[model samples]
Target: MEIIPKLDDRLKDSLYIQLYRYFKHEIEQFTFETGMRLPSIRYLADRLNVSNTTVQMAYQQLLAEGYIESRARSGYFIAELDSDFIESTVTPCTKLSSEDSSEQKEKHILYDFFMSDIDTDHFPLASWRKYANKLLNSEHKDVLKYGEYQGELGLRKALSDYLHRSRGVHCTPEQVVIASGTQSILHILYQLIRWKNKRLAMEDPGYQGVRRSLQGQDIKLVPIPVEKDGLSIREFKKVQADAVYITPSHQYPLGMVMPIAKRIQLLAWANEQESWIIEDDYDGEFRYRGKPIPSLQGIDEHSRVIYIGTFSKSLMPAIRVSYMVLPPALLETYKHLEWGQTASRLHQQTLTLFIENGEWEQHIRKMRTLYKKKQAVLLETIKSVMGEHVHVSGQNAGLHIVLHVKSNCPADTLIACAEKAGIKVYGTSSYLNQNKTSCSLPILLGFGGLSLNDIKQGIKLLHKAWLPYYKSSEQCSVTP
Candidate 1:
């Protein structure tokens, strides 16, 4: 029997991914029994009206993930899977009630433009696996033991060197603290800084995850408005904040790179007030417009900046590696505290090797190029498809751009319409701390996880979905 996948070109996922999912589903459901031979790449390509390379990629993915195996001079065959694994992995089908069915239909999103997503298809799996396997050897058994409370020394050293070379950050290996994620690092930072008044000023309409994290600690969060350049310094001075959190490299959700003049002024304020600046430089590696902006911590003459960087965007998020550079003041405080290691010692060791061998920088350059192209495609597609129906902002940097939809409907209504059309777009309303009505119907479209074709198709579908509500500025007033 021949296996055929029903591939839809209009869907967000590429043809190879769709084909892989189809086969994986079939195999999990036992439709493709153990030892059953799959159709040849050429045969399947011709039958499915896709390229042979696409079929080969799908088969390779299945083989790598252990869904199938290939014999020399023979076609692919289904791999024998453990019964318990299958039972746990596959959800049992159940007849849904009317309400459940409606809910499921509403949640069915074909294309997702999540701001935090990254391109997993382009991850350096082979390079990562090589280093991981090397660290798993008997000679490297020390990696399996409990690591330092601060983090792996080797990784910290590697990161210190990298930050200095790329972002102009000034820090020693002793100041570097590795954690599982940015939130984990933030929690630790809070502990170190909790001795002071717990008032922290953050960007208004900023990253909600960080806002929620700080709020959970009962820290007073003052929302400073973000202007066309970045955080408004004039408003920030009004609040008696103990510390300020800002994404200066590329502001989260808004994608504004804070100007150098503002950066100097903020640092001056921190120095004069004896306050701290928590700079979360997430996705600082993918600037598309002009020369790459040096980090906020780079310009700190007073050492008031606590710099945080993560590999979740540059590499895949599953790696779960984020590091922060503590100021000498905070570093001393952190040393006195009792905290266990959060990141995996083994994974940290592997990453250290990956970086030391120069693969980390190499990977960044490759991804920077790839993301630039994806961003360009997304912008061109929006202009061609959406035209004057939307006004795009935050386009020159980061993985996402903001689209202020010229429609009378609210952001939620536009999101619902897009959802109904099987497209997923995010809103900026949740980013605001209090002023929900301040923002217009602005939608965020992330291009990092999407293919070039997916971006085009998604924008076209979005235009068609919101066509009914499209109105001119003269006809209806909409604030961006």
Candidate 2:
């Protein structure tokens, strides 16, 4: 059968992705049975009125993802995915009770404000390819062998220098341990500290990923309330915690940068209580305000802080590289632990070259400018359209900003309404560790993956979606 997929040029998703999704959905639904032959690329391109190259690209992606396979003389065939396996691995979407087909119509989201996504358009692909090729061309024995368990020495040295200069972190190459990502690094650190029975303090409306990882390790988590400044140190003192996890540079989801005074106070607490502070400076490099804030680790003179940094936000997430700066005390513990190499030596070598040659710095500078403009547009559009009906925060840094909706509607209701209008906004309640908070119902709007035009249009559509609720409130005020 000839497959004719609907294609939209206005959408942010590329044609290849759209076609891939169509074929995948069809296969999943069993419309295309296993071993069914797919149409030739040129034939499908003609049927769908798309380019032959686009069809080939989509097919290649499907083949790579194991959704389809190719044989000699045959174009492509659907892979045999076991029904039981699919049912077990694939999560089912929550079905709506209402008879309205609105939920069905809301299948495609044109503007996705997903937080933690970086703009793939701005990534230094050309520079990265050049560096990767250069490293592969050289007959260096280092790339072929297993790197040091902690990571490549050259990459760690380069990272140490960059961290000291950019983030004001003081550390040597010996203190850095590179891992796959934040979760992996945290796993190693948790094992080294052995703080299982001890309570670990975290922000109330904090990063869910961090909280989940700690909980999985059987660590007792104490949720501390966060204010406009940062996490409440007063609440922290009340708990008998041995270690605390904080995103001091730019608080996740809420976007509060801890001031120097607060940083000093936290350090003093760590010193006095003989506790350790886990500082996650995830996106500290993208501060749009005056100067990037100095890292909390930089101020801890007592060596009571364990600094964690990731390249997921700054570079592409696919790189999967993160590093932790261990204090002198724990550095020995890490050395004795049975740990194997986590990050690929090839990637580590390329990253080291990228940093040593200053390309990484250049990329950061360029992205900072681009993200600042996108953020400004998102804020300006929201203020102009929503007016005082919404309160925006966390615009100082990072990829996302929080919108405190001033309506009586629940956070999920607003999110659903926006979804119906083809805009995706995330609820903040799920991020709360203790489910109870006095803060207004907030929704996170991420602009890192969107363009300036899309940001403006998305905010406008959101305002339109929420207009009726505020309009009714205004009408009631005048009538009463």
Candidate 3:
């Protein structure tokens, strides 16, 4: 076979190195199939107008790397490689057909029920922008500089006061550590706790982000089943875990609120075992039925609970601000690490001013009333449209609820069908651990981002999409 190597002189790479790369790229791209003999080094040197020595060096390097084999008198041949491994290493570039591309573009999402969305329309943008500008223009210029390694003291103080009054959490500004997001906070916590214990227990069908963070830290995870009340204390007791991460006020996806009795039991378990509890209050601000449930950290007397709160859901995801209330013991260790600030100082300063001015509280109040009505609209629409084909739960708090479908079809099929109809819904199977127990097909539907009219229309579309699989029955009653 006649072949030539392209070598660039200006690249600073040696001619032999360039030649080696060319051959390797060809082999990887399957231009030179396995067992295909390469051109004789002397002949290739003459063809490319290069010295035979350069070709020999390049061929020797390829041979050493196992990309080529030199047989006695037969010259060089391409080596047989694992096709799957080769494909994985080298991504082939190809263009999609215009028909297929246009089809993808045409799939416009008219309605999206994303699980972690909040009403962007009601965000206090004007007030926030004013405060942010004021902070940026301050004489100190501190907002432009790194505030604190732990976090800006002003933000922590405001958060401490707010959490104490609203969620019943007990903490001072010193105990607070600002983080970029929940995962960042979890990563820090994993670093601190892994020394004490590597086995961490998490709720089955829990938040996947937490699971991923723990797994990324190389910590062993024990899945504890979640019951109607909350985390099954019975199952939790059976395992020996260093710490348990839970969403007590409103369990993720499932929406089961951990009752006072269960919360007390959980604290007792932590106290007896000396195991730590991490309480994530992601959306504790939007309770519709009664007074908000007191935080697990507030009720803990033994200081076993580490409370985490975020403004992402209540305010906006782009804010990228979350805080962790560490126990005194952990705080001491965390201070020693001295991990410099992870969140933006400007955002923290602006948030501090907003919270201190009570503007944050006012915003929460407004969002709560608005979200409560949206939740009611969603539940009412599900009842009127979906009827007895499905059951719903996890309302009364948070921006999303769980819709339990009675059909035998997997959750993904329903989600795909909804997608075809320009509606978006999420499934819970991905959140489940390897040992998930519940057989019910559950999908999460969020109402926070959608208008009341959109919620009704989307539910009607979903009803039409799923009507075929649903068993005929009287309307299923659902309440928030």
Candidate 4:
């Protein structure tokens, strides 16, 4: 109950205020915590070397403020804690959002498999630290103020340079609008184009996160199936979608690089249909083989394509600096919508340093090397363990790949088996629409974060878990 009040700087008038502040800080810092009784007025006075009146006045002030509350007979205590406060502060991951009770409702545990996580182990912490310090120590006022909605000029310029040299994306900094990520940028796009009928054509088994971003928006999505060739452009001729979203460089779920012909075909179709194309160029920087295919935006002579790039896949997902190379036609719309309302310069400054100082390239080179090795090891393990029982696809460029399960077992069953083994794998049914149940059971597996040794062990666990199904298949094959 001893409240030590340091009253060295306190006088008569300000003493009460000072005392209140000191105690308030103590309560917050856990010197006096929730449900803990504070010292009486007499004890506080003796400890702080202040008068009884000053201590009493401060206590009264504390009670008046929301920092503390008086328990009528016993004394004052901190107010009852909010039961849901701890859970409320959980960090926003891809699925977790700020909403009503609906947000916390128990979704099926399979929801975890559907999650694509950034491999934190591979993040360039040293470079990030250098850039963060550079941003914070800079003398720029815009870094601290409400910054350009288009994003910091330096960052936009840096990104422009990067897109040109690395990914072959075409456009100046003015056409680029920095958003939190592709998801946030898509939201802005959703807002800008809501007046149109807004039927979006998305790739079948495409990036589900994109679909989720357009959730509850005015847009309607038409799912187009992906094939060995790439996004089935022939199918787009049937659907009357105004906008088509794609992962051109590395097609999602099936990792086939869209050849120059397909890319040209898609652009031509979009032009004829007057449809906009969103080229989500995620993980394009980590090419394991061959010369970098030019971006759809780079080849986009008609200005029908929007190029989206992110540091999330290369850097960690938490570093939300994704930019888009807009066509000239959309520049005014982007400027009008984002000006005085969106993006912060601090984020721009931070990412700008990462890009301009050559650290971004160095980091990308290192991760690309590491991820390539991981992919090789994962493939080796899968081949050795799972063998011809499953089919693998889309491990060519991105961090994740998909495996199609045999007709002997369903995808949900395999997913359930994986969870039981403490290994997570996603079933492709979620990516597919209503017709998913009849299709081959595709399991989306992320191998980027796992080490070669972990990948080996994980495959071992997976094989052991699937032994029952393997045995049943073997027994059924016997001529009994």
lDDT of each: 0.84, 0.83, 0.83, 0.72
TM-scores, each model vs. reference: 0.77, 0.77, 0.76, 0.72
Model 1 misses residue 264 by how many Å?
A: 0.7
Model 3 — TM-score against the truth? Answer: 0.76
Cand. 4 Cα-lDDT: 0.72
Error (Å) of candidate 1 at residue 250 is 1.0
RMSD to native for every prediction? 14.4, 14.0, 16.5, 17.1
Runs in model 4 deviating more than 4 A are 1-115, 339-344, 471-480
What is the C-alpha lDDT profile of model 3 across 196-226, one tens digit per residue?
4478888988899897776655678888989
lDDT of 4 by residue, 333-432 (tens): 7667744434556667777777788887888888888888878988898899977566687776888777765535566666655554556777777676
- Best-to-worst ranking by lDDT: 1, 2, 3, 4
lDDT of model number 1 = 0.84
Which portions of model 2 miss their true places by more than 4 Å? 1-106, 436-439, 471-480
The residue ranges of model 1 lying beyond 4 angstroms of the native Cα positions read 1-107, 195-197, 435-439, 476-479
**Minimal lDDT window, size 10, model 4:** 87-96
Clashes of each: 0, 0, 1, 1
Q: How far is candidate 4 from the true structure (C-alpha RMSD, Å)?
A: 17.1
Candidate 1 lDDT at 180 equals 95
